[model samples]
Target: MSDPAPVSTIVFDVNETLLDITTLEPLFERLFGDAAMLRAWFAELVLYSQAVTLSGKYTPFGELAGGILRMVGENNSVAITDADISELKSLIVSMPAYVDVKPALDRLRAAGFQLVTLTNSAPSPSPTPLEKAGIAGLFDRHFSVADVEKFKPHPDTYDMVAKAMGVEPSGLCMVACHVWDTIGAQSAGWQGALVTRPNNNALHAPNVPTPDFINSDLAALAGQIIDANTAAGKE
Candidate 1:
């Protein structure tokens, strides 16, 4: 087999890789007060993401978020207003970071890796979930697909991030919990690391490529990146 590519910069996927999405469950339950409805809303959000991509229909991620919220409210017998959706969007901006994310980011920075975030989220009027996570300053830069009017699994989205960081695709490592995101990055010629979380199960999506490395935690993936860089004389 060929040698592993050297990693100069690491780009993280924001939602599940760095942020703890579980926090949203309780918040949503409290806001809507119906467990089943909240779950269905989240499920539909994922479904809509795929549907939009497959249908070649481009919608802002925030709009999709609002749509899911409206569907849930309607299902739960609550009439949601524009104001209610706006408040829910604000809550998303304040979602907490995962426990392991900050330290892992610190370690990567200490090891001389530039860090950044490439997310499918829209550029919004308020602070993003990254700002709420308190690690907003940790990243060298942040990119949203809204800038390109595309979403994850799209090659242009990955290219946008690589171009912004001034790095060739091969020199940047895309770290994400979702296989599709990693596959997209890898196919676009960037190295990818799969940060496995409980809900990510490597679904058998046709034409999706596997990631370069798979680890259960960010710290472990950070170590691998450091080692890879050192081996390639990049450290």
Candidate 2:
């Protein structure tokens, strides 16, 4: 096998990786009496998005989020209405970037890496997650899986990143907090970085593509990328 490819461009996963979804925990707690259910609901959102996509039907992320939140509330015997879902979604746009995100973006950009975002969210008429977090200008391009009608962890969705960024898959590195995302991207010939988030773990399944760099947060992952490139230059 050829040696691992170097990263020429970095594509980020936006929702939990850049904008912290935990900001919505209080709303879940108020409605369900348990903040931790927010994590479960999000896990369902991701699963259902891919489940339908894999079955050759596609549902947009926001719609899946609404449906899953209702399911979760019903399971807990809480009464969440359509108006409550709308109110919860309204909070999505106002989430601040995670503490590690801005410095990591600054470092990677300054070190000459082209930055881009590829999210599962549909193209929105309103400001997107990055725009809402005030970092839209940091990206060279922003792509949504809506363009391909597929949610990520699908090889097709990961493959689209290369075309959107005008590079070979090997020249791209996917930075994500989810192991499945890293696995999908690396499987499609890109390098991968995993940011260790709460309850997230290293992938250990047979034939899985392990992360090229695994760090506790984005700032540390950016440092890994920068240092790796600097060391390569010396040789």
Candidate 3:
């Protein structure tokens, strides 16, 4: 290809992409004796989030997360009580941001790029996760999949961002740690950057399209996006 479209807006994914999911690991460990239970429950949460979308039904993300925690606990023969579920959900809004997230967001902001967040988390009045992460001001707005009754990897979910920004999806760059999220955005004609966080990378499949940019973390990815925008005279 001769050239790629410049990204006028950058949309971030909240969970592990910006906020560190491990912040809630201790709760899982206390309840299940395995901190890895947090990861397992999260996997189920995403799976069910997609499963409901495919079934033409909707479930709020927090509800799905709490339900999945029970499923994961049951799989290990632990009887997860309602109190246990509540305990975990209560910690969600307070999860900490990744150490690199603020610096990355700050760089993008200083370079004249619009930055915002798109999270699968259902909206709540308890203050957005970014607020709890201490990076709320870094984003212009926080969009949730709950608004569209769809989860990520769905084409409509990606379209919502462009519609909200009043720009064609091609003018937006979706920065996410999950390849599936990036793939969905690209399929909807948006630019994409894969954050390639630990245990997270693009799938190596024949039909899987790669993201326009890939880096080990948001800090490096921000640098790459800044360079690309500069080279394209967007800076």
Candidate 4:
């Protein structure tokens, strides 16, 4: 039997995986009078993004997020204004990278892995969140599901990255905090690494493909990926 391909490129999911989304808490608190609404609105944002994709329609992530924010506000009897939606979008694009992200990504780069990002968030003009966080140079490219008009966990989204990068799916490793993202990449024939960020967990279900690596810390996960790929090459 032929040996499986070694993972030469690491594909990261941005947003909550690398960037800290909790930075929006103060805005949420000001708008809804409760910081916890941040999570509720974000959860809805993701859920509906996929729902829209499944329904054969497309809306940019930013637009969808804005609409969901208003929905959440209405559901909770809070009023969300146009300025509030604008502030939310601005905060999202300016979120800081988690402290562990830069160093861990640097480590992966030093190990000679091609690093890239696949996000549902639309590609904005310069000074994107990665640039604002000062880690944009660490990546070779940044991809968005926006290019394919679909939210992630959709097979075509992963395929777009693989095709654009000029590599077979097996040559890529998807690093994401959300199981749905990893599951999508794995289904597309890539290796999957799960970063167990807060509220994210490895799914345990029959016939589900578990991640090849799982860690709460990006640095630890980076090490595992590097070591595994190194050993695989040696064999």
Name the best candidate (by lDDT).
4
Q: List the residue pairs that clash in candidate 3.
A: none
Better of 1 and 2 by TM-score: 2
C-alpha RMSD between model 1 and the true structure:
2.9
Q: After superposing candidate 3 on the true structure, give the runs of residues whose Cα lies further than 4 Å from its correct spot.
A: 1-3
- As for TM-score, the candidate ahead, 2 or 4, is 4
What 10-residue stretch in candidate 3 is worst by lDDT? Answer: 1-10
TM agreement with the true structure for every prediction: 0.85, 0.95, 0.95, 0.96
lDDT of 3: 0.86
Residue 161, candidate 4: C-alpha displacement in angstroms: 0.8
TM-score of 2: 0.95
Angstrom error of the Cα, residue 119, model 1: value is: 1.0
Score candidate 2 by lDDT. 0.86
Candidate achieving higher lDDT, 3 or 4: 4
Where in model 4 is the C-alpha error above 4 Å?
1-5
Of candidate 2, the 10-residue stretch with the lowest lDDT total is: 1-10
Give a tens-digit lDDT track for model 4, residues 154-191. 99999999999999998999999999888888889999
